[model samples]
Target: MIKITFIEHNGTQHEVEAQEGSTVMEAAVMNGVPGIEASCGGACACATCHVYVDPAWKETTGSPEVMEEDMLDLAYEIRDESRLSCQLRVTPAFNGLVVRVPEFQA
Candidate 1:
């Protein structure tokens, strides 16, 4: 299992264990981490799963694809480390990953 830390806009921290091969968005939603709406599930059609990847974990998580990049453009508070959580597949190497939710996602 991988450990994912989700920081909410209100500065709340929620850490949960996620199985490998599951999307970060799925793990967050399943564990009630909040802030991850996943409006289109894991299909990459919605930006509700957007999150800011901690700079320290950026290298480990890598960059998103062109499609995911396009979707992020529609997200609020877009940042240098912004990513669509649904596009991030969990792996053993991703354990202890940290992602922060934007203040606005509507």
Candidate 2:
């Protein structure tokens, strides 16, 4: 399992273990991490699962695809680090990934 940490807007932190091939949104939802609404599930059709990837892990997460970027435009408070958690697939390289949930998401 890959370990990931989610920091909520209120500074709450949730550490979760995710299986390979699963999306970051899946892990958060399964672990009941607050702030990840995942309203569209993992379809990348919505921005409810938005998160800010820590700079140290940004390279591993990579840039969003065009479709995801378009959806992100609907997310509140988007930043260079903003990402749709549903679009981030888990891999060994993401074992220590840390993301922050925005205020609007919480």
Candidate 3:
């Protein structure tokens, strides 16, 4: 299992375990991490799962796909680190991955 930490806007942190092939959104929803609405169910059709990739793990998490980027424009508080959790696949390098959930979703 890969370990991923999600920090809420209010600073609440949720550490979750994920399968290598799952997306970040799946892990959050499966583990009941607060603030991840996942409205489109990892279809990349919505931005409710918006999150900020921790700068430290930016390279490992990488950037969003063009489709995801289009949806991210609907998210609140866009930032360079902003990403749609549905687009990030968990991998061994993401064992310590960290992301931040915004206070609001699209």
- Candidate 1 weakest ten by summed lDDT: 97-106
lDDT for each residue of candidate 1 in 22-91, tens digit (9 for 90 to 100): 9999999999988898999889998999999999999989998999989988999899999999989999
Candidate 3 lDDT by residue in tens digits, 18-79: 99999999999999999999998999998999999999988888877889889989999999
Q: Rank order by TM-score, top first? A: 3, 2, 1
* Model 2, residue 27: C-alpha shift (Å): 0.1
Clashing pairs in 1: none
Q: Model 1: number of clashes?
A: 0
Each prediction's whole-model lDDT (CA) = 0.92, 0.95, 0.93
Task: Give per-residue CA lDDT, model 2, range 1-106, as digits (tens).
Answer: 8999999999989999999999999999999998899998889888999999999998999999999999999999999999999999999999989999999952
Off by over 4 Å in 3: none
Q: Give the TM-score of candidate 2.
A: 0.97
Name every residue pair that clashes in candidate 2. none
- Rank order (by lDDT, best first): 2, 3, 1
Candidate 2 root-mean-square deviation in Å: 1.1
Error of 1 at 69 (Å): 0.8
Worst 10 residues of 3 by lDDT: 57-66
